[model samples]
Target: MIGVLTSSMAIVSAGGLLFALGEPFIYQVTVMPFIALAIGVDDVYVMLGAWQDTRRTLAPEKRMALALEEAG
Candidate 1:
């Protein structure tokens, strides 16, 4: 999804910038961004699934709250 990609890109860009700014390009730094992105993507999928599982009869705001509660 666009949201996931946008967030992932932002995270990667920030990490890359920090690495370029004299931070050591250690293995953890090199791989952690991707690991974080994967976790983020998984979280999005879980949140979306929770949202979809919410009752259709509920109001949008209530549904969102329920989804968030479930996701959290």
Candidate 2:
């Protein structure tokens, strides 16, 4: 999903920046990005499920807000 990919990219970019600043890419550094990606994907699924459960009678904006609320 877009959200998962973007979050993974951000994490990778941060790690890359740290590497540019002389930080070594240790074993832990490699593992963290995958953990973050997994968490992000899980969150996306939760949000999507919340969106599906929202009332159709509500306006689109309201439904989105409600989904976010439930997801949060």
Candidate 3:
């Protein structure tokens, strides 16, 4: 969530800077931040679900590796 918000803010700030510098803004540039937010949220949910499915018997590092592998 923090990553998502930070990235989105960066994108928007860059876009605003470009616009201020006389660059022509397109609709997609305005919309892309929201798209990124959605994708970020989806990725988090997938990672969490994968983590939950990992075997409890495994060591913590192995469990994390499996979760990331499955999610990725």
TM-score of decoy 2:
0.83
Question: Each candidate's lDDT (Cα)?
Answer: 0.84, 0.88, 0.85
lDDT of 3: 0.85
lDDT of 2 by residue, 1-72 (tens): 877888889897898799899976678666887888888888889999999999999999999999999999
RMSD value for candidate 2: 1.4
Give each model a TM-score. 0.74, 0.83, 0.69
Q: Which candidate is the best by lDDT?
A: 2
Candidate 2: worst-modelled 10 consecutive residues by lDDT:
23-32
Ranking by lDDT: 2, 3, 1
Local accuracy of candidate 1 as per-residue lDDT tens digits, 1-72: 865686678887887788789776666566766777778888889989999999999999999999999999
User: Model 3 over residues 1-72: C-alpha lDDT tens digits?
Assistant: 765876778777888799799998687666778777888778888988999999999999999999999998
Residue 68's lDDT within candidate 2 is: 99
Q: Once superposed on the true structure, which residue ranges of model 2 sit more than 4 Å away at CA? A: none
After superposition, which runs of candidate 1 have C-alpha atoms over 4 Å from their true positions?
Answer: 16-21
